[model samples]
Target: MAFDIYDFTSLTSSIHEGLATFLPPVGVLIAEWLLVGISVLLFVAVFGLILVYLERKVCALFQQRLGPMRVGKWGLLQTIADFIKLLMKELITPNKADKFLYNLAPFIVIIVTFMAIAAIPFAKGLQAIDFDIGVLYVSSVSSLGVIGVLLAGWSSNNKYSLIGAMRSGAQIISYELSVGMSLITMIILAGSMQISEIIQAQSTGWFIFTGHIPAVIAFIVFLIAGTAETNRGPFDLAEAESELTAGFHTEYSGIKFAFFFLAEYVNLFIVSAMATVLFLGGWMPFHVGSLDGFNAVMDFIPPIFWFFGKVMFVIFLIMWFKWTFPRLRIDQILTLEWKYLLPVNLLNILLMTLIVLMGWHF
Candidate 1:
């Protein structure tokens, strides 16, 4: 039988039927859930390693230095080595630390990331969960990571950790408004929050191109705010090494530390994937108007590749911000969100509303 790579739902349905052939209904359901959980976990682990390697190389390129060249053929195994090292390290809890919350913090952070990942559409029918309000779901779910960060800091009983976590809370809280406003702007233009429907709406052209200036503004704002939301560099005041000595997770070690580390990269992926879906048209091939021949060629490249290509491009842009810019002081970070991004985002939303109402957007 010829395989149709584009029809992910068919593949998943076949698996469901196969499971049901022998197992009872409840057993099938449990089996499917277990499979999904395992698949997502594996994807997270592998993707985290790839992102770490990618970041190292990206940072090296920006600084004109070679990175991780000695480990397994262009340093392909460097991340794996690091993972093993982290696994073997000691898990230490300070005597004064609040043991329960301290241990639970990293799990909360990582689990939140996994939950957000479930909503993202990697390719056609490849999404884990297709909520009617996917945009709202992702935005709301991703913001909960701050609770874990706060817990890690307060429970650690370390002053520097507490200060760092406080900065993170303030940073995420301030930028989250901009992130929501930017998404709201696009949600206005798109008219529906369903991820698949939004992609289908872009069959003519991506929102970034068709919605023009307002769409462009929202995309830019989303990128900026998303970076802050992920607690990435420049906005990474949460883990500002120079100021707070490893920040909120300072007291965590071994796999606990690895959980915090892996969550960071996976969150970065989620942000990039969200940007791709909202602006670039998730899994949609690039098509130039009135150019059927060119578009047909693009269609041959496969939707999954198109999705990942756009995701990687956005990831590169975020990484560029990290390597090119100086880390902002916490005050400056808050000021950028409150004094600048928030006001512009408000006006942008209003403009988008007008555009949608007037049918000004193509």
Candidate 2:
């Protein structure tokens, strides 16, 4: 029972062994599964609320307005108030809408957002599921949100919803190409798609630095592509109220509308987390070469701090774009994707390949 590394290891081994046997039992397994499901649901719900509040505050700072200060301390309870309002609102469906699909679409979108979290590495030895192709798994699962958006838009049987869905589909598909290619470059350098391995590889030197010029280019491309992929800010054509009258979920109301709103912010969080893993060194501590004192000082901070700092930086940038820029025309959006991001990302990948082959990393 003495405090030692082996003692901790033995405890973990014993727990794992016990779970291996216990999980096969009918009653215990069902209870454990329910507990896990509840935990995930609660986490998503809380995170969605916090993200909404954070986005509002961040935007207000940029625009020089007081954001939600009337509710709770510093508007801490703003999301809670909004939740109450949404809960009390009457559910409305368009007369011509297909009830089943319209009703199901929001849930599908929200569920897919939750599923994407399964592959994200929150901290050392902390993840819901660790698959071999972790990055690819995340990409595949996250993209399914588009299907829900398209379903919501088309099934609503409204002209605006249909157009929003079509715009969203095109936007996601186009941006996914650059996002995938940029992530692949990191996978190439790390030689693995597992999130933990990617973070481990960055211990000596983050890929953003080790991968050099090509990595920098890929990072920029990934940020732009990720923004577009989530249908956020300048790329938020899907919800362009001015043009599409609330876009894909225009016909949705009450709790169903809340689902779409929650899904959008959750998707934003996922993309930001992914970017931190790929380019900003995930949970790795800051290290300056040959500066042992500085490195040691930095290591005192918890790994989760590094992770959140990076995520927040990206979130702030997204908010800046949202408040500062006008929404792009659909045609201009497509043109920006095909004419710029695709070609630049392709060349950047080729450059990374050459750099890797030449063994130029320090």
Candidate 3:
């Protein structure tokens, strides 16, 4: 069989077949899920470390200095070293903290991240789950992480932690409206909520182009709101060191703290991946509707490459925002969501609806 990096279904099916020769059907199924879960966990760890390294380098570059040059060649393994250190650190809880909820919060946060990730489509037929309401499932389920944040703060008995948690809850709740509306604008054009269907609809041209101005508006809004949703810098009021001093997870340490840290970067990838699926066409290559030759060249590049490229671009854009912009005040954060993003998002949806109704989309 020819190698096809873009399509993992066949390879995985073949493996499943080999396993099935010795195992029951139920065991095969359980094995598939377990293997995928392990892969995703590894991805979370590796990508989180990569992001930390990238952000540090980006920050250092802006400041005209070398970043992380000590450990392994250019300090590439700095984060890994930190991970080991964290593993050995003591898991400390405040004397007055709620022992149960304080311990449970980090797991809750990380679990929700993986739960939402299960729905993401990586490439053609490269999805774990394909619920008919995949997009809705992602947007709704992902927001539940805020509950973990809230619980962490309220359980910590630290006023700073409580304040940070409250800020994050309000920020995520407010921006979720813009994120959903922006995605809905794309959904209206695609006429489906399934991630695969959304990508299929964009085989010829991405929604960012087909939906035109409204699509552009939605894309920009989604990027902004989604960045805020992840509690990243510029919108990182929830974890402002100058203010809340490590924010909601301030009381956490050791592996529990590691979960919170890793979950944040995983959340970053989740939002970026969703943006890729909703606006950038998921795994679709760039192609004009009637240009066969051009499309053939684009197709030759492979679907997974296109998907990875777009996801990385969106992730870079978010990282750029983090390094370039200063953190906003709490009031400014709320105002941006309530006064600007929400209104603009609502109107953009209305415009998209009109365009769809008028059959103006290509």
Indicate which candidate wins on TM-score. 1
Off by over 4 Å in 3: 1-3, 289-291
Judged by whole-model lDDT over C-alpha atoms, candidate 2 comes out at 0.85
- Cα TM-score per model: 0.98, 0.93, 0.96
When summed lDDT is taken over every stretch of 10 residues in candidate 3, the lowest stretch is: 1-10
Q: What is the C-alpha lDDT of each candidate?
A: 0.92, 0.85, 0.90
Clashing pairs in 3: none
Residue-by-residue lDDT tens digits, candidate 2, 110-149: 9998889877776665566778899999999999999999
What is model 1's C-alpha RMSD? 1.0
User: Cα miss at 359, model 3 (Å)?
Assistant: 1.4
TM-score of 2: 0.93
User: Candidate 3 lDDT, tens digit per residue, 197-314?
Assistant: 8888988789998899999999999999999999999999899999899999999999999999999989998999999998888989898878899888988887888887898899
- Number of the candidate with higher lDDT, 1 or 3: 1
Arranged by lDDT with the best first, the candidates are 1, 3, 2
Task: Put the candidates in TM-score order, highest first.
Answer: 1, 3, 2
Which one wins on lDDT? Answer: 1
